[model samples]
Every structure is written in structure tokens, then in C-alpha cells.
Target chain A: MKHLDFWFEFASTYSYPAAMRIEKLAAERGVKVRWHAFLLGPIFKAQGWRDSPFNLFPAKGNYMWHDMQRVCQRYNLPFVKPSRFPLNGLQAARIACWYQDAKWLSAFVKAVFQANFVKDLNIADPAVLEQILNDLQLDAEAILTQAQSVESKARLQAANQQAVRLGIFGAPFFIAGQEPFWGQDQLELALDWCLHSEANLSSFG
Target chain B: MKHLDFWFEFASTYSYPAAMRIEKLAAERGVKVRWHAFLLGPIFKAQGWRDSPFNLFPAKGNYMWHDMQRVCQRYNLPFVKPSRFPLNGLQAARIACWYQDAKWLSAFVKAVFQANFVKDLNIADPAVLEQILNDLQLDAEAILTQAQSVESKARLQAANQQAVRLGIFGAPFFIAGQEPFWGQDQLELALDWCLHSEANLSSFG
Candidate 1:
């Protein structure tokens, strides 16, 4: 079976819907998914945007909120406009990166996304993250400790660098071989491409 | 029984694909389409972007071109990257705005898009505009002359103000009632909304 790399940023509004559904879609098609948690902060800083483009452009921001509501409605994803527009994703991402091979990775990631997007909790808060891990029946104490270790931090930094090298400007981005598909709207296209790609898993990043 | 207002800019890259298929799509859904040819130059200027955002942001530009390829491939629409990134859409928009209710509006709109995104022609030139009109078997000289009338100019200007009031910051935007959907990816959502909106054609703009 072919596979695709799913690059997601925890605080990315669109990535929330994508993260919740990617695995099921991939499973249905018998394709594999590699979840890569990376930061958009470094990438946006490189682009000279001090804030999310949504916040930077008021009109776009206004439209985005409404679009999100419509999208959530269409997908039947429960949504509550977070009191905080973009709560920091660093802690959640670090945990996700450190647990890249964890069997519970997708569940943890989805829980964090739901906490922030559906429940209006700040994902940057360690207490919130701890609760998420506790609910997942994982060793929260050990995982949190491991997530803060030098090796874990280095791994996350490496993922950020790889995201930059892959020319990812936003999330959730997908890679099938060397081809990239950006935005939640392209999820199916990316999955279908992954299954059909001649290069398949060999050339996927 | 229902209708939508399609906000398009001739220079917009994504709008090229939307323009070509909107009529067909709307027709299939038994929805009426109001082609609102408006200028993005003014809207973009207000947002402090002097050039197309594609030129301002290279990564987005790079991704957009490839995405266009993938989208066109999926839609079976022919596409060729124009040598001029965003050829001036002012003249073409003026013609479209003036002929908003003409029997040949959709044909003329699609032809102009084809000229820019398929044939790679400079749509800004009057000769190119005249040739498109001629090919449509219409009175090229008369329509071209009428397109420049003061009333025609003001009508297009009014559309620009209306688009701004509508908070449209992007092309391939659709309005069903008061609901706004941006990007070609949202085309079906907009059309569906138009069809199902309780207000139906009454509240459509």
C-alpha cells in the first residue's frame, strides 16, 4: 500500500478538521499515513508575518471564521470558536513529535485538537496537555519528561527544518512521493494520489 | 428557483478554473449565476499588496501553479501558465460588467479566461479583447465601444465598492444570500447553499 506524510500544526484552524478525519480516510483506501507535527511559527517568521495571516488581514480573518463554521457544519465536526484565536501549539507539537511512533499518537493529537478547537482550551498549557495524556491512559509524567528532553527537542527542531525544506507554507499539508497537496480541501486528492502514485512509499518524505 | 453571485477577477489565477465551469455546474444544480466581474487591484491595494500575492509570496505562488495543474487535471480543463503573472483584468472586467445580462456573457467570460490561462495571451490588450469578441460572432466594435462608456465605467466601479462592502478579499468568491464562500474549492458549497437557502432567490445578491 502507498502512504502519505501529513504535516500538521497544532494551532492551525483548518488542520483540526483534517487531523480528525485523515486516518479513517486513509484506512478506507488501504493507504498509510505518517503524521508529522511541525511548527508554523518558524516558517511564518521566515515569511515576515508577525501573526497568523488571518489576524493580519482583518477581512480574511472575518471570512475565515464564518468559513470554518460552514466547514464544520458540512463535516459534522463539533466546533466552538476558541476564545483565543491561535493558542500556542508548541507543547502539543513537541509531545506529538516525541511520540511519532506511539500507537496512541493519532488519538492524542485529535484530543489536543478537540481541546483547543472544540472545547476552547489553551493547548500551550502543560496542565491541559497533561490532562489529555492522562485521558489517553498514557504515562503522562514520563511522556512529558521525555518531551522536554534534549533529544526530543532536537527531533522537533529537525521536523521544523524538514518542513521548511519541503516548502510547506501551511498545514495540513500532504506529500505523496515528492508531490505536495496543501489545505484540508486537498486531503482526498492527496490520499488518492498516494494510493495511485507509482513511486509510492519509496519517494515519500 | 435559486441563485448565486460569482465574484471573479480576470487576473486571478484560480478564478480561471472557476469561471470556466461555474455556468455548467450552476446549470446542473438548477441555480442561476450572476457574474460579477470586479477588480481586485483596488481591494489588494487596500490590503497593502501592490502586486499579486503570488508575486509577493513565492512559496504560495509556487504551490498555486502546481495545485492549478492538479485541479485542472481533475476537472479536465486545459491550462497553460501565462507568461505575465497577472495580466491586467480591468478592461476585461469592464466588458464583463457592462455585458452582465447579455445572452453571450458566459461564453465571453469563458473565452477571456481561456485566452489568459490556456492560450497565454495578454488579456489586457484591446486587440485581444476585440479578437475574443470577434470569435464570439458578436459585433466587436460596438460592444468594445459600449464597454468604455461612462455608465459602464461607473457600473464596474459600483461593483468594486460592492465587493469591498461584501468583504471579499479573494476571487472565485460566491455569495448565496448573505453567506460568503471563497476559493474554487468552495464552489459546490456555494452552489448547494444557493439551492437550499430558505431565502432562495429573494435574498440573493
Candidate 2:
């Protein structure tokens, strides 16, 4: 079976839409999606940005807010502009790393995205993450505790390193075989590559 | 008829695609396209960039080249990487400004894009601009000379000022009423807005 890797940053607004819909879309194309939760903070810092570009450039921020509203409306997805520019996703990402290969990873991702984009909830708070885990019937305290482990922290770091190595500059990025597709809008294009490209199927190798 | 403003930078890679295809696409939608030839240099300078972001970030530049190849292949259009990074489009833009109200503006725009991206020619050369004009059955020397006049220079400047006032930060930016859509990818989205948006159709007013 062919697979596409989805690299996402929880703080990324566009990733919210990709997260909400990628699985169903990929499944329709007979492709499996490998969800990889990563951080954009380190990447931005490397680019000498102290904050999200949306905040760094006011006009861009205004345009993005308006664009996001339009996009969400088109997709019929619930969207409320978060009061905060970029919600800290460190805790959520760590927890995602801890449950990286778990069956409920996608559900956890959707819930976290909903918390940040739909509910406008601060995802950085431990209590918020714990509540989400409880809602999923997972052991909240145990998972939260493990997510804070030294090894768990290192795993998240490794993921970021992998993303940087792959030349990923933004979130909601995809790798189908050797081809990298950036942006939520390219989700379908990536899926098409996964379903069709025969020569580069060994790219993941 | 509803209208969409297509703000393009002659040196913009993405604008090449939008310029080549917008007229036919807009015609199909019964939407009128207002081609606005503008310079992105002032906007980039305002953002404190001395070069294209593609040059500022190597990884992004690499990805963009690959992306452009894929896009061209998908569209079945001729693609040749230009010899120069961002060809001096100042002359081409000024020429475009002089022909701004001409019926052949779209054809000239497409021809210029093909020359730069397809043939990898130096669009800044007066000889090249003259050749393109002559091919279109226009008086090459006369138009080229007129394009260099003081009034024509001011016309280009005023167009750039209008783009800045419209919050256009990049090439191939589109404005359908008040909704600004940035990037070549948003061309269809902008057209769709032009066809369906009634309330915001008076945005330009």
C-alpha cells in the first residue's frame, strides 16, 4: 500500500482544515496517511522570526484572518478567530508524539485543533489537554505524565529535525514518495501523486 | 459585468501562469478581468527585502522551482528555467503600462511571460520588447520609445501606488470586489467570487 506523510504544526491555522479532512480524503484515494506532529517554533526561529509571520507583518495578518474566514466558510468548517495569534502547541505536540502510533492519534489531533480553532481554547494548558484525553476515554493523567518524559521530549525534537531535513518550511505540508507538497490546498494534489506516481514510489526508502 | 483586478509583477514566477491563462478562464466565467501591471520591488523594499524571498530562503527557492515544474507539467505548458533569477522587468512593466488600455494587453502579457519563462529571453532588453511588439503587428520602435516617456513612467508609478493602497503584497494578487486573493493559485477563487458575490461587488467604489 502507498502512504503519504502529513507533517503538521498544531499552531498552524491551515493545518486545522487539513487535519479535519485528510484521513477521509486519502482513504478515498486508497492511500494511507502517516500523521507526524511537529513544531514550527524552532523552524521560525531559524528563519530569524521571533513570532508567526502573521503577527510579524500586520497586513499579512489581516489578510490571513480574512482568508481563513473565507476558507472555513467554503469548507463548511467551524472557524472562530483565535484571540491569540499563534496558540502554543508544545504540550499538544508532545502528547501527540507520545501517542504517535496509537489508533486514536487522529481523533486526538482533531480534538486539539477544534480546541484551538473552533472553541478558541488555549491548547497549552495542561487542564485543556487532560480534558480532551478524558473525553476520548484515554487515561488523561498517565498520558499527560508520559508526554512530559525526557524521551517523549526528545522524540518531538527528532520530529522537528526530520521536518527541517525534509525542507519543510511550513505546516500542513505533505510528502508523497519523493515529492513534497506544501499548503492545505495541495492536499488533493499530494493524494493524486500517492495514487499515481509509479517511478518514485520508493522515495520513502 | 463583474470584474476582477489582476495585479501582476512582470518578474513574478507565479504571475507567469496566471498571466498565460487568466483571460480565457475569465471569459468562460463571463467575468471581466482588469489587468493591472505593477512592480513588486517597492513592496519588497517596504518589507525590507533586497531580493525575492525565493533568493532570501534557499530551501524555499528549491521547493518553488520543483513546484513550478510540476505545475507546468500538469498544465502541459512549455517550461524553461530562466537564466537570471528575477530578470529586470522594469522595462517590460513600463511597456505594459503604455499598452495598459490596449485590446492586445492580455496577448502581450502572455507573450512576455512566454519569452521570459518559455524562451528564457531577457525581457528587459529594448530589442526583445520591440520584437514582441512587431510580432503583434504594432510599430515596435514607436511604442518602445513612447514607453520610455515621462508620462508613461508616471503611469506605471501610479499603478504601483494603487496596488500598494489595495494591500497587494505579492504578484498575481487578485481583488474581486473587496476580497483580496493573493497568489496564482487563488485565480479561480477570485473569479468565483466575481461571479457570485453581489454584496461586495461595489467594493471598488
TM-score for every candidate vs. truth? 0.94, 0.95
Clashing pairs in 1: none
For model 2 chain B, give the 10-residue run with minimal summed lDDT: B196-205
lDDT of 1 by residue, B136-173 (tens): 99999999898889988999999999998988999989
lDDT of 1 by residue, A45-130 (tens): 88788889899888899888877777787799999999987789987899999889889999999999999889999998899999
| Candidate 1 chain A lowest-lDDT run of ten | A196-205
Docking class of 2: acceptable
Model 2 TM-score (2 dp): 0.95
What does DockQ give for each predicted structure?
A: 0.46, 0.43
lDDT of 1 at A82: 95
Tell how far residue B186 is off in model 2, in angstroms.
Answer: 1.8
How far does residue B200 in candidate 1 sit from its true spot (Å)?
10
lDDT of 2: 0.88
Using TM-score as the measure, which candidate wins? Answer: 2
